[model samples]
Target: MHQIEKETVLDVRGLRTEFGLAECPLVAVDDVSFQVKAGEILGLVGESGSGKSITLRSILGIVRPRGRVWGEILWKGRDLVPLDEAALRRVRGREIAMIFQEPMSSLNPLLTVGLQISENLAAHTDLNSKERKARAIELLDMVGIPAARNRLGDYPHEFSGGMRQRVMIAIALASNPQLLLADEPTTALDVTIQDQILRLIQALSRDLGMAVILVTHDMGVVAETCDRVAVMYGGRLCETGLTADVIADARHPYSLGLLRSIPRDVAPRTPLYSIPGAPPSLNALPAGCAFTARCPVAGPECRDVRPSLETTGRQRQVACHHREEALIHFSAREAAQ
Candidate 1:
């Protein structure tokens, strides 16, 4: 683990995203705020439908038309939320790029991998056709594709699952983006291939000085790759801090439950810890704490008011009515076991 330099590159402030124009609009992301510094890898960890993916999409201005988004997506102090389509085009690929979960789907089956990568360079850079083609080959080589020159002409279906993912990464880095949004980049791969992709992303971020936001449900992946983490639940960030702090001593009940669900040194066939109740419906969320129904330590006060995020410790934020007591008891319980 290396020390992260604290110079904010992307600052998301008070972000709120919604879906539906008809009755009963759903708030998928609510008042989410976070910052990514140069070369930092921030992990957004939560179960499916926790707004992790929506929050990432909101930053890149890729949310669908039905999805209403408002807030500041500050890239180097410039707000992207108000930027028009043409202006956003200038910022999207060259400044920020994303590697989606499914690479085979993200890549074009009709086009050669080289053409797909060079398209970004052609659109965003001043490079001529020959130079763009050369750069595309270089990107393919950089992402560790074997036989880069020959493989450049291959279509998405011509490559293996991991190879297709590598092609996606090459295209994403074609414009040399400063920020990379990776939405479950390794979810579809086997464990061996997942480790390889994670290492590739880590190495690329270090070599390129690119900030990264990795959105996934795998806490183990977060532990292995992230510098800091933000844990979301029911469209709200429940806890956030350094990876070490959040994993070892989680303050929020939801975060704690997530950590406990990871199989540790327990006996074989042991049932994993699962949080009670399903995630709240965004279209009809409860007035008070969205997690109150599932939280084990919930009390009367938790049901009366929605808890806002508050500073729980140094560089740690938690949204819970019982954070203080929960931290103390949770820490003690872990120590005991």
Candidate 2:
């Protein structure tokens, strides 16, 4: 994937998001960088509170009032970090759209589904009242909502979980955005519905040639959907590579642990592997590697010095002191098991 050249849609560099007091702020995202090319799906995967969602919010300049975001968010070569609210408003939803995790909370309860989709159309497109209504129906139909014309007046609660998600996707696709940011788009849905939502997103991206950054805690979802994966831990990227390469040969210890933690069909009573210890508290993060306490191969240097993300192979980057040795150690352990 990296060998072939493609148009870069989004290039994030040294992104740091902070909240709370300025003097002693909680670093939600630290020195994170990645790129998304046209018609590509980049998975931002990690455990909860790993700054995956915050990174997306920061990129859109939608962080809470108490929070501050720094670093370059280059969308089609334009840096969005320094843009004012008015400038950002023009970029968001028009050129870049986001599908939130929970459609119920994200969608307005008082507004009808038609009106909600029309609102985005009005905001981003030049469609008039009649045109907006017709486009809304088309969008709904495109997202596979049955009886799209008749369901225009339905409220958020009137639809099932899966239908609500489709409506959200319809709203996101209202303006034909070039980039889509999806934050756990299938959260709380059943497995079957989750698959539908994931497939819909993948198909839409391919059809529209839209670059997507999908945030999720599930590595299994990444394995199935993403072309590239960036594994984050305690607000920092641990490893990034093509999904297949990372799944088969992860270089970071945390990335390896996450891959090994996925549930597999084994004999009855077989225990699933789980990462030991919890993620580090953002406010109390260590000066060295955040995973030092939980890392199986952590050495004295890992406890004292932080490792910067370094190129390990083609299209692969890892932030670990023992990148080479970690792969060997984890591979042997999995073989033994």
Candidate 3:
């Protein structure tokens, strides 16, 4: 694997996505902001409907027509928020590519595997039919597809789930994209295949110097593969920092709850702890902290004021009124967990 140059590849600041409704707007992404440097893995984690997928959609400009967006999404120093349709199209697969969560639905069953990959190459490059075919074969091989040259005519249904996902990754990398947005990229695969795919992504990001933003709710995956981890709650970023720090010394109550709920591998019989309350609906969120309802540590102060992202003892940034001080008390126990 090649070394990545030290630099920031993508920066998102104060991003908010709101869907317009009859009398009220639904805020799907609420003032979420973060950055991904070149050649690093950043994990965006939250349960379903917590806006993890919506945040990725916001970055891709796939929000509904009635949605309102606010904030800057800078890619390679250019703000993608203001880009026109044509320009965005040109940039989509070339500079920034994405691998969908459902690999089966993502690929066209009507088109052969080679045709799909070659189409992307043909669209972006001035390559002849022969040249495009050659590039497609190479991409398939690069993505670890066995007997790659002979599979050009195979349709989506011919491949297994893992192989289809490998094809999706190959298509996303067809243009040698600088940044790859992987939304639940390995969710459908079995454990062995999941690890294999994650390893492949890690290898490729290192080899190609590509920045990766992975969306998943699995804390174990984040701990294993991410350079940094960002926890989202109620459409907002609740915490973000180096994976080791965030996993070891989480500073927010919600984050603590998430960590606790995961089954420990070493201590096989340890009971799984879960937060009691459900997550808040965006339309009817509390006036103060959105997580206050489910937080065991929430106090009168937690319900009175929303906390900004503040630096903590571990140099982690957490959004909680008491995180900077009180959360550290649980840090040692969490690390041992």
Candidate 4:
């Protein structure tokens, strides 16, 4: 076994979450499973409402009321889903931390940024108020906030968007977590700032030996930052493999469609093809394959059978029928079609 796959810090099995409604239930996350190894960055990529964010939230035991969650969320051999809220809170930000999407909303507008960070440290650590303040400044400094000692007195509104994100990351890292769940951390930032944030996350993953789960919609960012990637469609995982392998030899029609829609920078753009039809709504999933409606090469078989995660190679899996044909000379096939 590869070192990356063997030393997994987080292993999710058969994770499924459904929300109740009057007529139909909203299956936000459906049987999605993957492992994040120690010090590895696993990127979760998909369109909005693909359950990437919801899955991360469920891991934190923050799934909404009327939501039925099944399966195990394993961390260090223990199941987290069954843990009480108080126990989970203690585990969170210490053993496992999360940087939520939209740092501005996550941060307290009224409190000083340092206090916000200190509160996290105070919750987990036995540090005194003075000691916590010192640690909070150090955390801010580690995240590249200059004059952090002075910045401790400043509120979230005082800093720019990028700086606010750094503070959010600082708070997430305050307790020295073993795993970091970054839910679309760069979604609201500019491209230049996004690169900076991604690089910082990569640095932290390496420097601290912390596993990172990066939830994002940008395939290009995954190509740059993630060691491995999993693609989701309609609350289900479509494909997963080494970032390079998945990008080069995608074995699912949904994966192929995502790659085709976003032509790489090196590729000469030819009208920048878009996938036909929108992503399926979680409240009303299609029968069999959720992506059948949009898949270019979808067949009757795809419409009749729902494929589970099938290992096509070591540490590589794809949920799709006609996987063989999906990996065939995609560029040539596109031109010919």
Root-mean-square deviation (CA) per prediction: 2.2, 1.7, 2.8, 2.3
Residues 1-337, candidate 2, lDDT per residue (tens digit)? 5776779989999999999899889999999999999999999999998999999999999995677999899999999999989999999999999999999999999999999999999999998999999999999999999999999999999999999999999999999999999999999999999999999999999998999999999999999999999999899998999999999888899998998898776668888899999998997788889899999889889878999999888899999998777788887887887
Q: Write the per-residue lDDT of candidate 3 for residues 35-117, one digit (tens) a residue.
A: 99989999999787788988888887878467767899998899988877788888889988999999999999899999999
- What's the lDDT of the predicted structure labeled candidate 4? 0.88
> Which candidate, 1 or 3, would have the higher lDDT against the true structure?
1
| Candidate 2 segments exceeding 4 Å error | 1-4
Question: What residue pairs clash in candidate 3, if any at all?
Answer: none
Indicate the residue-level lDDT of 239 in model 4.
93
In candidate 4, which residue ranges exceed 4 Å CA deviation?
1-6, 21-24, 265-270, 333-337
Mind sharing the TM-score for model 4?
0.94
Model 3's TM-score against the true structure: 0.92
The total of clashing pairs for model 4 equals 0
**2 or 4, which is superior by lDDT?**
2
Identify the candidate with maximal TM-score.
2
lDDT measured at residue 241 in model 3 versus the true structure, 0 to 100: 92
TM-scores for all candidates: the values are 0.95, 0.97, 0.92, 0.94
- How accurate locally is residue 13 in candidate 1, as Cα lDDT from 0 to 100? 93
Q: Which portions of model 3 show Cα errors greater than 4 Å?
A: 1-5, 265-271, 313-315, 324-337
Q: Write the per-residue lDDT of candidate 4 for residues 92-188, one digit (tens) a residue.
A: 8899999999989999999999889888988999999999989998999999999999999999999999999999999999989999999999877
